[model samples]
Target: MFELHLRQKSTAFQIEKRCKALAKVIKARRAPPWPCVPTPELPAKVVSDALIECYLRTNETLLRVLHIPSFRRDYEAVWSPDSNPDPTFLVLLKLVLAIGATTYDESFSLRPSAVRWVYEAHTWLSAPDFKHRLGIPSLQANILLLIARQATGVGEDLVWASVGSTLRIAMYMGLHRDPAGLGPSTTTPMVAEMRRRLWNTILEIALESSLNSGGAPLISLDHFDTEPPGNFDDDQLTGAEGEVLVPKPDGTFSQTTTAIALRSMFPQRLAIVKYLNDLSSRGSYAETLKLDTELRAAYKTLTRTLQTCKTPTNGPSDLELRAVDLLLRHYFVALHLPFFAPALKETEFAFSRRVVVESALRLWRAAFPVPLSQLPTIDDPLARVAISGSGYFRTIAVQASIVIAVELTSLMREEESLGLGPVEVRPDLLTALDDFKVWSWKGMETGETNTKGYLVACLVWAQVDAMRKGMVEEEWVMEVVKAAEEAETRCLGLLEEIEARGRQPQDAPFGTATQGVGGDAVVTPDFGVGDWDYMMSDVLFNTAGDPLSWVFQ
Candidate 1:
């Protein structure tokens, strides 16, 4: 039903108008149908439970997308439903409820209707005239919906593309740029600060999408002059007037500035992503070291209270700990982007072996399963910071596993040249592959059409899952050559299955295709997933002479 062509469009002024019109047409087609709902008013208990789940669990862990400390105040006003209704707020409330419902299993009595509640929120969001009301709350609602898709476990991934409208609408409303030039009415310190936070949030989301979507963000520093959000929480300001600085989320002043700690790092990290986007033009290692120093300098310049990522001798506040975790994952993102540089591709291993190994270690710490005593929040047995994550975190897991595996082989090959210590990837690599398979299953069980996990399974030979299948340990770790051959044969079979599916004439799925975030790369009709035509052996085997270092040294 759709063509999946990867074309490079020339930058020219000639087709700007035509491009805009075509975009609108495609977006309109992507819109969901008028969603059905019973009513916006739900019982106070249901509402309370959901908000509690959101703040205590979802907000901190999976969906740290909101200005929670402030949004909580606004959310409280209409949470009981005695006031006049606003459509945007209503959407936010419903999505909050949807994410709340997903925190538990279906056996809970209120869950089925939560499904209806989610669609009801979309109904308000999808209203034709709703575009006219796009503003701060609308942007908030769109981001919440996007986060909830992964948090709730029932929503589809491509459906998350609905935020494409939010990005555009926010741009059209001029939320991307600071409104200082608009008028005095738009220039209040309070309003100025709000614009900064919202704009930065949009930038962060756009940048995140760009990573997997392979598309550049609609927002760039060149187009926007908005300053970074101030460190204050929402209650510090009253209406258009602003005052009252708070150093922490709990209204105490130890040192760490509340809320915007993560936001502050967005620009530097985003620039790194863009810089590494082109494989052909990797700067020299010295250039990377300079960029690395610059990035670390920005990080180090933060106040001591802001350095919560260092595992303080005194325990950190929950908010500070979350910041620590988030910063670590983002650091790996910055560290690994350059590994994708073209120069790395010239060699059998990823471009930068040192950064790859370092990133893999750090990311493993971020997403790796920890003992219960080490977990920041352990309210429920099933809850995990990474469990509710969208594929991004798990994608990191897969990348780390593969990269570490590459390191193992590379070390074995270069043992004579570089006297590197022995490396063992069995446990960490097994864990990473396990995490990947878990997420791939969740993505599918929650209504995924792509059989992505099937592909990841080919990598480790399901070594972890083999125990579940009653296979003895020796069966999986058999001699390397036979394992490689079997992996090749199995991979070919999976590729053939995909090829067969492509050949069949099938109707397009109901909604309009979600355009991928990538503007430069080719995409599958389903979006970023591409044809797995290159054999699995491409990644599975690497050697100096033998060319098949499947096992570690």
Candidate 2:
């Protein structure tokens, strides 16, 4: 049995600690025995095939967890007339299908099945003897399970801890060292390349979870000397012993191209995360500028090389471009977030605010080129998957929305002070708010971070609305205010429904209880009760009452 609760802590920087504290929700429980094999839970072959293909097309670009050709061969054997697949491979197969279900459909109709598959895979990995039996397939299963969990919103908040443990395992497996350093007898060229690829994937995911959780990254450049994967597709390297391998030309668009390009700046990104989240000693503004410059240079290299790749369609797809843009621009926002609000008051730091706002705007545009209501007609299906299937990406969108709202408030305040022309809120602000409300409604069904996100969104939206109307008591402003208020009312109602559901008693399904051993029920945070509004206010402002002044620090 387990319960989720907000951590209540006091510190010197009390407001900032309280704001960042929302990210951590601890669970109290003990492990239960692993379930039996999930063979009966497998979907039809046709359905499974479609889901796997979906995962390959959308997620495999960044995740790079599995070699496509190898996985395809294994997949074929799984359905053979007289074949028996390996147990570990079965675990990997389930995870692939679980993640595929999310990418295959934006509505996630198969989410329940996906969740079950993830839990089963997790149990297999949790066995005591599993570490003794660790191999490439087991490592692959661990990585894929993390992706599946993120896609299905299972253990979404605990990804950082899981990734940390995975990091230690990879290091213990000697993946941190380039396989070339090992004797040729120990690893073939194909195995060597796969090792490098897997290590890169592990490092990337670790950094991502660290950023999402606002924790220090477990990786540092000094901690690993593994070389980057070559620019080659899965088919280029045959798995034969003593086989020589050749990489494709730089201009060619191979499967490993994006991963390689990102690795070029992995050190800088790691430094950025460490600096942003480091509690003991953060770098100075000058150091932040240096990282900014390096990141921009790396981004430039990524675009130039990726743009030159001669695909059958002529260039990279829109989703590829958007995904890359959103990812790199997020660093731009985080790099300057500490100085953003201060820049509004001090002309010297205005550049920081400019960077934050511009980067955040670009991030928002890339993440949502079209409004949420028009999702069905979106040109790039991969973009839809990237946005809706991954909890990490959704968190980025929420952060960007808050940035937009904060900026809009500043603009309205300026207009009021100068008695200037009306400040028009960008259309994308409403687009993001609409999506926030949609997510909130979905949270009513699923019950998790989405509800809290929407509640914060509503508060920010109302505050912005008030400021806009105060600038000029106009009819249109009033209309917008009314709409914002209505959204808040609906959001509060949904929160009530969610809390009501959380209060109900339930039997243990996956060997976890809803109630404690002493008949005490699990306690859920009451949004309508004491200090809830104060918490939201703390998120929106700092102790000085300056809007959007709260950064991760």
Candidate 3:
């Protein structure tokens, strides 16, 4: 039933004959030896479980965004190094091997060696002549290295240096410009196609890193004419004129690939956001609303695979993880669009307070199916992409917690305004906060304790006391609202204090912080957007001046 998952399997019989002749030479003139680092050199013949783990980890996680060329030939080259020893390719292969060892399987007993391999790969890059070897191929190594750092869950900012350099290197290669647009140019079809794939990969990495870390993109969309990758296997693609090939498989994304649907969807969505960012003046409310709709439409258009997952119970299979990854992209769009709303807007604006609350609720609910409490570690499938890099799961949970808490109090106020007796607070609101706490404990394990606790703590307590009304139903008092405000202020103040002390704020609930090595501040998650951003997703409200920001219509 399993079709050809990897091309290497399909062609092994034919390749083995050619490989036998080459292996003799590779065995004689073995790979460039770095004796100091303890990571083992790759063997020229059959790969062990260790290499498979590396390839699996690298392919599953990094290829979520990094779309590189075909692996079969490149991999064969690794086995036949004497035929062509591309150092940059070697560096990329090592990084992939390193990541596999570090992240692919927790049950994988070879973890210590995976960690060693990561260092060995870095040492390979640190060699004195590495600079001289920098070229387009080196871009692939740099990206893989960044991904390895991210996958290790100790994501730091050492990648910023890599990112900044990657943009420049891509520019030098004319990767930002489409070769197809180059009328009268004679660049071969194979080369042009490869450049297109690599460029899109760089953009995904750049956009994700920028948005997640609050860093600016290395290159803007306006500069690039390169197209998203075609929905075909590399074998089907050829340099010959007018050649058509196999289409992307119908159905869901592969757990091991950057799906063609995503490769197509993500770049367009990013382009919309980039356009919004570049606007010199805020667009008219109608214009802004149109843009918001565009983002949501993109989400609706995503072609998701139907993965029937039994989460945290039997755990998600690898296919289920790919399904989760695709849906998370929708969450990213949902959380982002509402960020532009001004809750106090006119009727013309579609991004109302209701839209914000609903979006937050969708995000909160999404975290449940394989919620953090059920998972054993941060490396679990549900936690890996959302938790490790952007701390997006944490951000959505806390943001939703605050918004829902505020909503409960606002409802009571509405009843009082209509001259009716005060209504009781919803039990669901209280339960949601407790659920958030359960989700947050994993983050606390990673040094994110205070921020997660403070989000709905005092607010929920205050609301519950009012709902109980000292065991007697009483009219809602303005003092309840005031108390909630004071508690929020106190929470904000505490988070500010933490930030002042140079520990990342507790306001960024549900995420961990990794101090940069040697005081470098390398891969710290910018999981630090203030909860206030959600209260003003429309971004038109000045929460600073308003007394009851969340209460606005």
Among all candidates shown, the one with the greatest lDDT:
2
lDDT of 1 at 499: 43
Identify the superior model by TM-score, candidate 1 or candidate 3.
1
In candidate 2, what are the lDDT values of residues 474-526, reduced to their tens digit?
44344444444455455455545444544576333332211111122221111
Clash counts per candidate, in order, are: 6, 0, 17
For residue 276, what is the lDDT in candidate 2? 89
Off by over 4 Å in 3: 1-90, 97-136, 153-162, 179-191, 214-222, 234-258, 266-268, 304-350, 371-380, 388-432, 446-553
lDDT of 1: 0.47
Screening candidate 1 with a backbone cut-off below 3 angstroms (N, C-alpha, C), the clashing residue pairs are 213-518, 214-518, 215-517, 215-518, 215-519, 344-351
Q: Which ten residues in a row have the lowest lDDT in candidate 3?
A: 509-518
lDDT of 3 by residue, 440-519 (tens): 43343232324325334543555555654532222223333444345434434443443343333333111211111112
Clashes of 2: 0
Q: What is the TM-score of each candidate against the true structure?
A: 0.60, 0.77, 0.56
**Residues 1-553, candidate 1, lDDT per residue (tens digit)?**
0011101222212233333444344333323344553254544544455545644453543224444554565555544334433445555766776656544432223333445556566555555554334445555667766656545433444532655676666665565566555555434555555566666666656666566555544456677665666645445544423433433443233222433555566667666666655454465656666666666765655434454433445333554454345444555455555554443335633445556566675665555445322445434312332444343454555566566545443433344234343323446544555555444434333322234343344434443333333343355333222333443344344434434544577553323112212123321111111121111112211111232221221
Task: Give the TM-score comparing model 2 with the true structure, all chains together.
Answer: 0.77
In what order do the candidates fall by TM-score, top score first?
2, 1, 3
